[model samples]
Target: MIYQTAESINDGRAFLKIDEFIKNNSVYVKIENMNPGGSIKIKTAIALVDAAEKNLDLKNKKHVIESSSGNLGIALSIICAARKYNFTCIVDKNTLPHTIKVMKAYGAEVIIIETPHPERGYLGARLDYIKKRLVSDNSLVWTNQYESSANREAHARLTARELLNEFPVIDYLFIAAGTTGTLMGCVQTVTEATPATKIIAVDTKGSVIFGTPSAPRYIPGMGASVLPPLFDSKNLFDMVQVSEKETVQTCRLFARRYGFLVGGSTGTVLTAIRDYSPKIPAGSVVVMISPDGGERYIDTIYSDEWCLQKGLLQLQSSTSRNTFSGAVVE
Candidate 1:
C-alpha cells in the first residue's frame, strides 16, 4: 500500500459525496477516517510532536505520554514508533479493546485507569494519572492534546486548507467536537477564508464542551467530561447536540444505506445534519467531517449484544430511514 509521510498524511485524504446518506444534493462528507491512523487525530498528533521537536521539549526525553480515549493514543503510538521514540498511552475504561491493541501493536505501552474522577469521570482520572507521572518522570513528555495550541494549529494549517481547496465555496461546515482541537482549528481557518460559511459544532448531549452536564458516556472519540481549553463558542455559527441513541441510529442508517460504518462521533455529525436539515437553505453546500471509521467500534456501536445491554437495541428502527433519499455525485 502506498503511504504519505507521517508529517504530510493530510495530503492523502479527500472528500467523498455521501449525499445518499444526507439525502441532500449539496452536502459532502470528508472521510477523515481514511487517515492512516484511522482518524483526524493523526493531524493533531503530528502537529504536537513537531512542535515538541521544534521547542526542544523532547530533547532528552525518550518517553512520550498522553491521556486519550483512543484515536489520539493510536496516532501518537504510530508517530512515536516511526520517529523511534517510546510512547505511553494513558486511557480510561471506556476505550475500546481494539484501540488499545492497535496502540500496542505500534510499540506503545498502554495504561488503563480503572477509577473515574468523582466530578469529571474517566477523562479526569486519565488526566490526573498523566499529571502524577509528569511530576515524577523528567524524561516523560506529555502531548497534552486537550490544552495544546499545536492541536488546533494542525487542523487550521492542514485540515481547513484541504476543505477550502476541495470546496472553495462551502456554505456550512459541520464538525464533531472532541478536545475542540478540530473544531477550533477549522473554525479559525474557515471563518477567515469563507466568512459567509456557517460552522456548526456537533457535540454529544452529555458532553460538557457546551456547558452541558457530564454523564457516563460509552462513545470514545468525541465528548469530554471536562471542558476543553480550545473550545470557543463565539466563533461557531451554531451548535447541535445529539443523544447516544440517536447517534447509534444514524450509524445504523449509514451501514444499511451507504455500506459505511462510521464511529460514534461521525454518527453524531450525521444526526446533527438530519436534525438541522430543515433549517439549512436549499442549494447550499454542507460539509461534515467524519473523524474516524466504525471498525474500532464493532464491539460497541455495531454490536447487537452491546446495544441490547445498553438499552440501545430498540433504537434501530427502519421507520426513520424511510424519510430520507439521494444520489452519489459521480
Candidate 2:
C-alpha cells in the first residue's frame, strides 16, 4: 500500500453490494468516501486543475476560488494545497461546520455567506459574492462549479468510466444532484454506452433542480436553489426529490442497521431508493454512489441537538424502518 501523490488518489475505489436492503433489487453502493478528499468530488477537483493547467491558466494564476456547499470545496482545497495555489472557498451558512474546518485545515481561505437572496437563496448570494470579488480582484479565478464545463466533463471522463467499468450492465443508477455534474456525467456515459440503463437523478425537496420550489435547504451535498448549467433533462429516466427529514431518518437508519454513518446526500439517495423501489423491476442491478462518509457531518446531519435546533426531531418519532415516504420538510 504505497502512494505517490495524495491529491490525485482516486481510482479503483471500493464498491460493495447491499442487495439485502431492498427486495427484488440487487442494490450496490460505490464507497467513494475512501478517497483522500473523503468524497467523490476528488475526481472533479483534479480534472478542473488539470484542465486549467492544460489551458495555461494555472501558470500565472496563483489563487483559485469556487462556491461549494461542502464536498467540492474540500476537494479543491486539497488540490490547491498540494499545488501550492491560494484557495478561497465561498460557502453559505448551511455548509457543515466540520466541512468548513476541513477546507480551512487543507490551507484554504474559507468565506461564509450568512445571507440568502429572496428567491435565489444562499447559492445566489454566494454567486453574487464571487462575481463581485472576481471583478475587483483580477488574480482570483473562480472555478464556477455550476457553470464550469470542466466540472461536468471531469465526471464524464473519470467517475462515469469508473462506474461503467464497475457495473458494466447496471439496470439503474441513482445519483444525488447538486450541481448535476455527477449525475450528468453518468448520464452522458451511460447514454452513450448502455442506453438501457435508467438514470435516476435524485434531488432534495427544496431544490429547484427538478422544477421543485426553492427554499431554505440545509443539507450541503445535494440540492441547489439555482438550476445548474450542467443539468440536462433530456436523458433523465426519472427524478426523486427527498426531504431533509427523510435524509436524516435514512442516515440514522443506516447507522443503526448497518453501522455505516452515511452523509446527507447518500441518505437522500437511499431514501429515494426505498421510496422508489416499486418502480424498479425485480432483481434489477441497482447501483448508487455514496459520495462521502458521515464524519464531516458530525455537527448537523449527525447531531440530534443540531436536528432539534433545526426542527428535524420528527424523524426519530415519525419515520420507521419500513416507511420512508419522501415528504416535503422545507
Candidate 3:
C-alpha cells in the first residue's frame, strides 16, 4: 500500500516509521524527502537563495544560475518561479528527462551542456562557464551548490534538527555522500546533540571521494570525483564504497520490500546497512538516509529490461529464466 499522508516539515510525529526503524535497530534514520521539494535539496535551495538575497542587492537582479545533476536544479527552479526571479540551470547532457521537464515547467530556462568527458558530465565545466558568464553579466547571481555554505547550513539546521527530535537516542547514521551538505549537516547536529553517535559515509566505487580512481557513475546524485569543500571527513567515523551493481540491486529490493521506490544513492545506503548490520551490537541501532524517490528513474533502474541490458539482471541456466541476484528484503 502506498503510504499516503499529508507531508509536514515541522511535525516530528509524521516521522514515526523512520524513528521506529532507528529504535528497533538502535540507530535513527532521517528521511529528508519529507521536505517540500521532494528531496533534501529543498533545505539547501531555500538557504542558498536567501543568503544570496541577503548578501547582494536583488532589487533588479536579472537571473539566478546554477549547475546541478537534477534535484538541486529542480528546487532552485521552483524557488525562482515562486519568487518571480528568472532562473537558469546548466545541467549535464545525461540528466533525467523528467527533471528537465519539471525545471522547464517552473519557467526556468534549462541549458543542457554536453560535457567533454562522459563521466564528469558538465558539473564542473558548466560551473566554470557560468562563472565566466557571471563575470561579464553582473546581474546574474551564481548559486554554486557544491561549495555553498548555505547548502551545508540548511542540512545542519533543518534536517539535523528534525532527526534529533525524532530519534533522540540514535547511535549511528549511514548516509550517502553527494555534495556533502547533508552528511556535513547531520555530522554537525549529531556531534552537538549525541556526542557518541557515529556517522558512516558511503560513496560509490568509482567516486574519488576517498582518493579512489575516477570512473563513470550510473547513479546521478551521490559520489563525486573531486572532494567537495563541504565534506569534513574527520567527523565521519568510517566510510564505505558501494558498487553500482549493489546500488541497483538495493534500489529494486527497497521497492519490492517496503514499497518505497528510492533512487540509486538510497540503494547504496541500504547496501551499506546490510554490510555493516552484523558488526553492529545486537542492541545498537543503525539508520540510513534515502535521498530521493524512484519515479525519476522509471526508464533506467526501475525497468526490468534496462536492468537486463545493464547486466544487473541475468538468466539462470537451470530455469532458463531471468532473475536478479539481489533479492529484496525488508
Candidate 4:
C-alpha cells in the first residue's frame, strides 16, 4: 500500500482522483497547484535562484528580473523574498490585478507596460523592457524561464521523480505547455524511466508552440506566442490543442462535478485527456498535470461577467469532447 502526503508545499507531490471528474478509472491528476507558491512555477523558480547562488551571481546582483505577470512572478517573488533578493516583474495590461497584487504583497516590484507591441502584443513589450533593464544595470539578473535549461531540469529532477515514485509504470502522461519547461522536463524523465509511457503535450489553440497559427489569445498560462526553445518535437509522443472556449467549459465542468477549480492550462490538459481517452488502451494509468488552482483566476476565467464579455459564458456547462486536429498520435 502507498500513501501520499505533502509534508511541505515544496514536497512536489500531490495527486487527486480523476474517477469522478473524467469517468475514467485509470486517470489521475497530479495537483501542482498545491505547491507553496500556488503553482508549479515555484519548482523552476527555486532552481533558477539556487543556480544563481551557486555561481555567486546572486551575491553581486542587487535585483532579479522576470518577464511574467502570472504564476512565475508570484513564485519568484516568494522565493526571492525568502533569500533576501529584490525582485522585479514586468507585466502588461492583460495581467490580472490579483496576480500583480500577490506579487507586490511579497515585496516584488511590478512594472506594467502601457503600450503593446504591434505584432506580439504585451509579451513582446515585456521582453523589450527586460532587455532595456539588463542594459541599464549589470547587477540585475534575469531568469529567462523560457530558454533556461534549469527550468526544464528542475521539473525533470523533482516533479517527475515524485510522479514516478507513485506510479512506476505509468502508461500515459498529459501536460499543459506554457514555457514548455514542464512539458519537456516531465517527458525527458518519465520517458526515460518508463520507456512505454506515452507523453502528450497540450497547448491552447492560439498558441504557436505546437505549430498552430498565432491568433489573439485571451487565455493565459498554457499557450505561447513564441515557440519556447525547450520544446522538442521528437520528445513528445503526441500533441493536442484546446480552444479558449473549450478550456473555460472544462474548468466549469470540473467545478460542477468534482469541486476542483483549476487554472486555464489545467483545463486544457483535462480537455485533451477527455478527447484522447477513447483511443487510450484499457486499464492504462494516465496522469494529467494541473499547473495551478483557480482562485487566482476568479477575476478573469472564473468570473461570470468577464466570461460573458469574452463570449465564453455561452460555452460553459457543456463538457462534450470535440474532434481534434493538428495533433500527432503515436
Candidate 5:
C-alpha cells in the first residue's frame, strides 16, 4: 500500500544551495527533504510498515503504536492514513506543535508524556506501555524504531544507494546519531561502495548515546539518553558530541549562510563538518546529511522570541529585546 508521489529531485536547488557549497569546499550536502514526507524517515516508514504488513497482521489491526518526537512519527502518520490504518504515537511533552498538528491531521491518535524520565524520554516509557498493552491484546503492532532492523535496512537500501549514486568517491560521511538506523545504514553503504570513507557519528551533549548525563535538551532529534541496541560503535570512525547551544547556533548560521532551514540534528552534523573540515586533506569529498526541513520549528528555534527566551540567540548590544527577531547579525 505504498502511496506514490512525483519525485522531488526535479525541484530546483534554489531552496537547497548544494552547488555553491560543493564548489567552495568540495563537500556535498544531501538534502533528504526532497522526499515526499519532507524527511529521510520516509524511507524507514515505507520499509518498516511494509515489512510489518508482510510479517504481522496489520490489515485488520486496530492500531499501530510507536514513539517518536518528530519526523518518524509524521512519516508513519502519513503512511498509515493513506493505507487506512489506525496509527497512534506517544511523544514527549516538549515536541513541537507543528509535529503534533501534522500527526492529528493525518488521523493518528497522539499521546503526550512528561519528559526527563529515569528511563530517558517518552520513547522508553511508551515502549514499556506498549509492551504491557500487547500482553492484554496481541492485535496491535509495535514498530519500535530503536530496535527494528528494518530501520537500518531502510537506510542501507535507499539512502545509501542514493549516496553511492550521487558521489562515487566520498571520503567522509557525517550523520547525527539518533536511533542509529541512519548512521548504521549509511555505514553499511559506505562499507560496500566507498570502504575508505570515514563515518563520523555526531551526538548531542545530553544524549545518553555516549553515556552522557541527562539534561533538558532542546534539539528534537540526535541525542537519546539511552544507547539504542541498533547502534554499532565499531562501524564508526569517531563520535563527536555537540552541545545544545552549538546545535542551535549552527542551525542559525546555516539558515543565514545557506538559506537552508533544517532541524537541530542537521545542525549537529554541520557543526561536526565545521570542526572536522579543516583536518581533512585537500579536495577530499565530505558529505553531510540534512535529515529534515525547518517548518516544524517555526514556533521554537525558528521564532525570535523563543530563541531570546531560551538564551539561544542574542541580539546586538543596546538593541531592545523587543526588536530582536533572531535575524540580527551578531
Candidate 6:
C-alpha cells in the first residue's frame, strides 16, 4: 500500500483514514489534505523547518526562502509563522491565486515568477530567483526541497511507517512524483517490509521528472519541470505518465461519483490507476496517496470558463472502466 504524510506537529492529525469506494479492485485513498496546510507537503515543510531550527541560529531573524508551486509554501508559511520566522516563497504562474492568498494570510512574503527557464522551466526560474535573493541577503535560508534529504527522510520515518501500520497488505501502491521525496520514502519502506507490492510512480505529461521531455504543465503539486535530486531509480516498479486532460477528467469524475473533490496530483494518481486497471487483477488491494484537496482549484480545474479558454474538455467518459493501458516511461 502507498502512503504519504503532512505538516501538523501531531502525527495523528497528519495521517488521515483510507477511503474506499465501490470498484473492482479494493482501492483505498489516503486523504493527506486533511492536514494543517491542506497537503502532504506539510511533512516535508516541517522536516525542513525542524532541521533549520536545530542547525541555524534563531537569535537573529531568519528569513526562510524556498521555491514552491503552492502547498509547500503554505505549509512553510504556517510553520514559520508559528515559530516567528520570516518566510519568503518564490512561486510561478502555475500556482493558484487562492494558494498565494493562503500563504499571505499565514504571513509569507510571496513572489511570483512569470517567465520559465529555457532548460529547467519554471522551477529553474524560481531557483534562479532564490539564488539572486541569497546573493542580496545571505541571511535568507533556502529550504531547498528539491535537493533536501530532510524532505525524503521525513516521509520514510513517518509517512511510510504510519501507512504500514494501518495497512499491512498493499498489493499495489500509487504515488505522485513531484520532488520524489514521498515516492522514495514509501517505496523503500514497502519494498523492505513486503518486497512484493508493485510501486507505481505517477507523473504528469509535461514534467521533466522520469526523464520525460519537458512541456507546459499548469497543475501544481504533481510534477516538476526539472529532475529532482531526491529521486532515485531504486525500488521503482514502473512509472506512469498521465496527461493533464485525464487528470482534469479524473478530478471531475471523483467529485461527481464519490463527492470527493481532489487536487490535480490526486487526480493524476486515480487516472493512472484507471488506465492501469487492465493489468490489475480483481480483489487486488490498491492504495493511492492524495496529496491535497481541490479547494484552491476552483478558478482552474473546476472552472468551465478556464477549461474552455485552455481548450480543455469540460468532461470525459468515466475512467472507472478500463479503456486503455497506461503508458510507462522508459
**Which regions of candidate 5 are displaced past 4 Å?**
1-24, 314-330
Q: What are the Cα lDDT values of the candidates?
A: 0.83, 0.83, 0.74, 0.79, 0.76, 0.81
Worst 10 residues of 4 by lDDT: 321-330
Each candidate: how many clashes?
A: 0, 0, 5, 0, 1, 3
Candidate 6 lDDT over residue span 207-286, tens digit each: 88888799888878878888899898778888999988788777877776567888999989988988887888878878
Higher-ranked by lDDT: 1 or 4: 1
Higher TM-score: candidate 4 or 5? 4
Superposing every Cα of model 3 onto the true structure, what RMSD results? 4.8
* Two-way TM-score contest, 4 vs 6, winner: 4
Best by lDDT: 1
For candidate 5, the TM-score is: 0.89
Clashing pairs for predicted structure model 6, backbone only: 1-170, 6-43, 7-42
| lDDT by residue (tens digit), candidate 4, 65-151 | 998858999889988887788999998776779889999999999999988777666677789889998998888998888788888
Q: What is candidate 2's local distance difference test score?
A: 0.83
Better of 1 and 5 by lDDT: 1
Error of 4 at 116 (Å): 3.0
Give the alpha carbon lDDT tens digit for every residue of 83-199 in model 1. 888999999888999999999999999999999999988998998998999899888988789988999988898889889888889998999999999999999999999899999
- TM-score, every prediction: 0.92, 0.92, 0.87, 0.90, 0.89, 0.89
